[model samples]
Target: MAPVPKSMSGILIDAPGGADVLQWKTDLPVPQLQDGEILVRNEFIGINYIDTYFRTGLYKAPFPLVTGKEAGGVVVASSSPEFKEGDRVGYISDHAYAELTALPAAKAVLLPAGITTEQAAASLLQGLTALTFVREAAGIKQELGVSEGPWTLVHAAAGGTGSQLVQILSVMGAKIIGTAGSPEKCELARKNGAQWVIDSRSEDVAARVKEITSGRGVDVIFDGVGKATFDLDLEIIARKGTLIVFGNASGPVDPVNLLRLSPKNIKLMRPVLLSYIVTKEEWRSYATELFDLIAAEKIKIAVFKTYPLSEVRQAHEDLEGRKSTGKLLLKV
Candidate 1:
């Protein structure tokens, strides 16, 4: 094993702003592990939209934060009995833009033999988000009275979390309608298991979805586009359906009028991934199912690009600009 270094390099932001605020430095001190923590030398860092939320001040954090939520790496030091030196793991934790991250043991899972470090980094956060939301948020389960699946709509279907949602919904036998910006992305969404695709930019999304469902509207909608599509979601959701809004790519949704939900008795939810897996048991159960799907080739990971740590600014720009598809990673 390589000896632990006294210092590390990573992107640091002193204040919330735009991509310009992300600064790369080589002299940051290595993080000291607290009890129930493990120190990992990160090989690949997952770049998520939530990272952008923190960078742009939409999601508040203390100044000088090393903003990152997930990474795949090998554990180099452990203060917990559950992990040992050289264990390959993927974890969800803060301060992950760095080459070294001190992770809480409970938020991590040991990488199975068939899963690569890069794959783990790419899929863990988004995959688990899709899995938990479909199971818990939408309640689309065979045992929970959705035996024949539901008519589901996933916005941004070619994007990271969107792709995963499409794939999982397909596995659960849902008839999926996906929306994307372009023809190529629409094709990608189809390949990821969207049975029907809509060109959100040039098409009438509500009309297309209504026609596809034979004027009945979809049973559930997974919308990450926020304000840009929130009203439209209400237009096409079935009575007693669920609307799970999980991101703000086109900006936050304005304050909603609760009276709007009264007509259809629509179930509205705005969920964060962390809230679903607060306990170790919750984390482990979902993570194990996610890895099983990966190993079985039921869920395919699509990495749009892996940027060098220094090019993180460009990466963030591409992500926020909606220029990339699938998962984005940083090579640490």
Candidate 2:
């Protein structure tokens, strides 16, 4: 087993702003473990758009902050009986932007057989988010009464979460109409299992959705683009359909008019990951399903790019610029 170091290198943001605030520290103290806590020497760090939000102050952070959400690594020390030295693991936490992270034993999952540290680091957080979005937020079971019965639409369909949504919907045999910014993205969405791809840049989303559904509209719409696509989603979403506004890559949505809900019986929801995966049991269940899908070769994780931990700014720039699709990882 590799020896644990007393100090580690990490990225720190003294205040929220752009990625410019992310500074690499050469001699940061390795976190001390409390009882039932495990310390990991991180090998791979997961870069998520949420990190951008925290950096930009869209999401508040107490600084100086180390703002990463997930990472994969090996346990170097543990005060927890549940783990020991050299256990391969992946963990989720808000303050994860470092070479070493201390996690409560309950918040970490041992990498199962046949799953890589890279896959665990990349998949655990986002994959479970996708599973929950499809199974719960979209309410696929309650909405789709028949096998292969429902039609679903996913905005930003070539995105990290959006692609996973398409894959999960395909597994359930649901017809999927996905929207993307360009033709290349449209093709990527199709490969991820979207039956129809809309170039939102060139196509009228509501008109195309109506044309595809023949005016009945879709059973569910996953709207991650926020204000830019909200009006279109409202107009084209089916009567009694659900619209899950899970993200805001464009910008935060405007105030909604509840009066519209009465006319169409539409349901609007904004589901967040932390609320659903709050409990260890809940975490375990979601992780189990996500891992099963991956282990069984049902969900294929796509990493578009990776950066050494030093280039976190570049990773953030690429993600925030809307320049890439699928997940981005950081080599810690």
Candidate 3:
């Protein structure tokens, strides 16, 4: 067993700004486990666009807070017997930027052998987010209705959550149309199983989408790139199509009318991951299926960059600047 330390280190959010303000702080308590909880010595923390929001003050925290949300590690202490010391585990929980954190045993999923800590860190949050959006928010149930054509559209296709959603939708027999900023990213999207990739920066998204489906828009459109993509997403969905607006990467959109919702009879939603995986059973079920996808080699984790924990500021900068093609990580 690794020697347990009395204190842990983490990135501190002092004020919101560019990556310049992120600070490394030591001496956070090596949290003691409560019943049903375990202490993990985190090895890697996932870098996400949301972390940039928290860092730049686009999203506010309680102040002087730790900044990361997902990590993979080995359990060193457990009050729950179901998990033991040295178990390879990873989770999506608040405060994961720290070198050590107390996590609920139930919420921490044991990683399979051959899955690196970096891959585990890369998968948890984004994978679960994708799972919830497709399986719940869009009502993509297993039964294939006769009216259902296996077609879906995803924006920001090379992004962390977007790529996972693309893979999941493809494995479920959906013909995927993915949009990205560059031709390189468009090709990456194709490698991830997107049947068609449109360079949204150069092409008319609605026109290309129409061409792909022979003037019929996709059955579902997953839009996370907010204001920049929302209008186009709305314009491209077929009548009665489901449009899920789950994140605001390009900032929030202006208010629209209820009448706008009626024109196509579109089911527009703003989904948060917590809303779908609200219970322990739901988390386990979704997480298990996600792991199975990984284990079966059906979905791949794309980590484009990694930095030492102290460079979290730079990591956030890379993510928010749209310089990262896939997932980023902070090695603890």
The prediction achieving the highest TM-score against the true structure is 1
Q: Give model 1's TM-score versus the native structure.
A: 0.98
| Ranking according to TM-score, highest score first | 1, 2, 3
lDDT of 1: 0.93
As for TM-score, the candidate ahead, 1 or 3, is 1
Q: Tens digit of lDDT per residue, candidate 3, span 66-149?
A: 877789999998899879999989887778888998978878877877677778899988998988888887767556533243
lDDT top scorer: 1
Report the lDDT of model 1 for residue 32.
Answer: 92
Structural RMSD, model 2: 1.7
* Global lDDT of model 3: 0.84
> Worst lDDT window (10 residues) for model 1?
140-149
> How accurate locally, in lDDT, is each candidate?
0.93, 0.86, 0.84
Candidate 3 TM-score over all chains jointly: 0.94
Q: Give one digit per residue, the lDDT tens place, for model 2 in 88-204.
A: 988887677888999899999888888888998888777878888877787665344223758899999998888888888888778899999999999999999898899999988
TM-score of each: 0.98, 0.96, 0.94
RMSD of each predicted structure: 1.5, 1.7, 2.2
